[model samples]
Target chain A: MMRAFFRVAWIVVKKDLTIEVRSLEILSTTIFFAVTVVLMFSFGLVVDGRPLNDVAAAILWVAIAFSGTLALGRTFERERHNDTLRALLLAPADRPALYVGKLAGILLLLALVELVLVPLVGLLFAAPIFVHGFHLVALLAGGTIGFTAVGTLFAAMLVRARSRDVLLPIMLYPMTVPVMIAGVRGTAALFQPTPDLAVAQFWIGLLGFFDVVFVTLALWTFDPVMTD
Target chain B: MHSDFETLAVIDVARHYGRRKALSHVNFTCAAGDIIGLLGPNGAGKSTLLNILATLLAASRGRVEYGGRTAEQAGADIRGRIGMLGHDLFLYPELTARENLVFFAQLYGLSGAHARVQAALDRAGLGDRADDFMSGFSRGMRQRVALERALLHAPRLLLLDEPFTGLDQASTKALVDRLRECQQAGCIVVLATHDLDIVDGVLSRAVFLQNGRQVGEPGPGTALRERYRQAMTT
Candidate 1:
């Protein structure tokens, strides 16, 4: 049973990856959007010769959150265009397996965006985020998991709604407050001149806990929420 | 191959959206080898009935039983055995015809899925275009691919709604031939369409619905168009 579940999930992942690889639509748009936002932030915030590093953590999280949402929307939007989500729902595989598969795909796209955004932010803002690279990676994983867990659930729920474009962020942002806070604080701690591993670990731990809670919730609720 | 005990019993099924009723007290029984045409005009609840049978939407007031088990009782196992092709193509336009079939076949847990996907592509007469992206296909090609996807699992019960929307004459004839093959294999087919000519010679029975009610059951002897026109007017 578990093997079948994974097999189905792998198929879904492969399908999404194949489309993404061919078009590069979601990845390119998301990365471009993130970099543009980061650029806007850099130019908008100039405080008396203060380095951008002071607020770089917040800036990075904002870029990720917004761009992640964009990626989630585009990812599910593809399904909506051809009613492929309906086809997916008709499949007899476990619905949670479907959710996990989509979550993995969205995570991969968001990771790519972050990979580019992190380096770009380092170069433009001179944040030195890579110096504490391990801590940064940990924070990114936790925050991303939490964000996409709930983001994926909502995105699926809203896929068929006529107002999905406006509804997605409206419904998503409020639910993800804890994730964003932990991400910003954890990243901020890592960015400090004298990095505080303890603070960073605590926030990362909180983000991890949130991810566990929401992923479980998402898996449990996906079937009911998606089915009529 | 189809199930020996193929039957679908929709008993007193009804669906409502707040104060508006989409379907009410709908009742029907379909068995294997039956090609049932669901004829209705606009707002006559044909799509809603098909959706209910597809398990995409739950009937608010009654139950649908497959092989003596309710959908809730049979669960995903039953769902796995039912194939559906609605008005939407239910395909990823970015994927090639072969890729789309393979993906759905895998989702259905078909063993030797790659070979089965190839077989389906061949059966759909899309072997030559299998590698081309669906985004560039004509409407008839997309319909053929959608039909192939639905048949990939060899489902015992097939539900199709407005499947002839975009097909040309040759594609439509190809679809009729495939559906005839399905019926011969003892697969129950419930086709919903407004055009009576499409299923005229193929349909084993016709059920006419109006305002969420099954107003008439026109058998093979009766001209379905006459029945449909009468049902809608009165």
Candidate 2:
């Protein structure tokens, strides 16, 4: 059973990846949106000779959060377009496995977007994010897992809903508050002149906890919520 | 498990969508080699019933049993053995015909899935266009690929809702031929379609539904159009 679960999940991941690779729809749009957010913030807030370093972490997190939401909506919107979600549901694979598979795909795309966004934000805003690359990656991983875990669940739920475009963020943002907070604070701690490892670790741990809780909840509720 | 393994029973199945009764007290049984033609007008619960049977939607009141095991009991094993084709083509427009089949076959966990996918594409008469993206294919070609996808796993119980929606004349004849082959292989087939003329010769029995209720006892050889007209009016 475990082998089957992993195999099905891998197949789903491959399918999504192949589609995204061919179309470049989700990755391009998400990265563009994230870059725009970073540029808008940099232009709006950067004062005379004073970097927006204090709020750089907050800006990065907001960019990721909003762009991640966009990726989540698009990932599932593709499924809705051809009624492929229903096809996946009708397949014999485990429902939670499907959720995990989609989560992995979304996480991969968001990671790519972040990879580009982080450097752009650093170069544009003069924040030295590259100095704490390891810590930043950890924070990004933790927060993104939690964000996409819940985002994948809600996206699947609202795939067929009429108001899914507006409803996805409305339903997702509240649930992801912990993720955003942990991500922002962790990034902030890493950016400090004398970085507080303890503070960053604490927030990272909280993000990990959020991932565990929401991923488990999503696995349990996916079958019921996705079915009629 | 061979042909004898095919059996599907819907016992007192009722589905309600927030007090709107889509299906109420819907009951039917299908055995091996049974091609049951499900006839109903719009909003008569044909798709809803097929969805329930496909395990995509749970019944509000009753249960669907396959080969003496309810879906809840048989779980993924039973689901693995059932194939369904709904209104949607269920193919990714960006993927080629062969790629789509390979993806689904892998998901179904079929061993030698690549070979199976190729065979299915050939069987669907899409072997020549296997490399072309579905986005470029005509609606008839897409429907053919969808049929191949449904038959990929060689499911024991095949449920098709409006399987002939977008097919051209030749494609429609080809689909009817494939469905006949499925029936001959002893798969329990439930086809929900309004085109009684197309399916009349292929159906072993005809089941008429009206307003979520089974209206009449129509035998396999009964004239379906006459019976359907009578059921709809009276």
Best by DockQ: 2
Where model 2 places Cα greater than 4 Å from the true spot, the runs are: B1-4, B218-222
lDDT of 2 by residue, A1-228 (tens): 899898888889999999999999999999999999998888888887456566888998999999999999999999998899988998888989999899999999999998999888777767678777788889999999999999999999999899998999999999899899999999888888888889999998998899899999999999999987
| Weakest ten-residue segment in model 1 chain B by summed lDDT | B1-10
Off by over 4 Å in 1: A47-49, B1-4, B218-220
lDDT for position B215 in model 1? 82
Over A80-163, each residue of candidate 1 has an lDDT whose tens digit, in order, gives 998899899999899899999999999999999999999877766767777789989999999999999999999999998999
TM-score of predicted structure 1, chain A = 0.97
Where's the lowest-lDDT run of ten residues in candidate 2 chain B?
Answer: B1-10
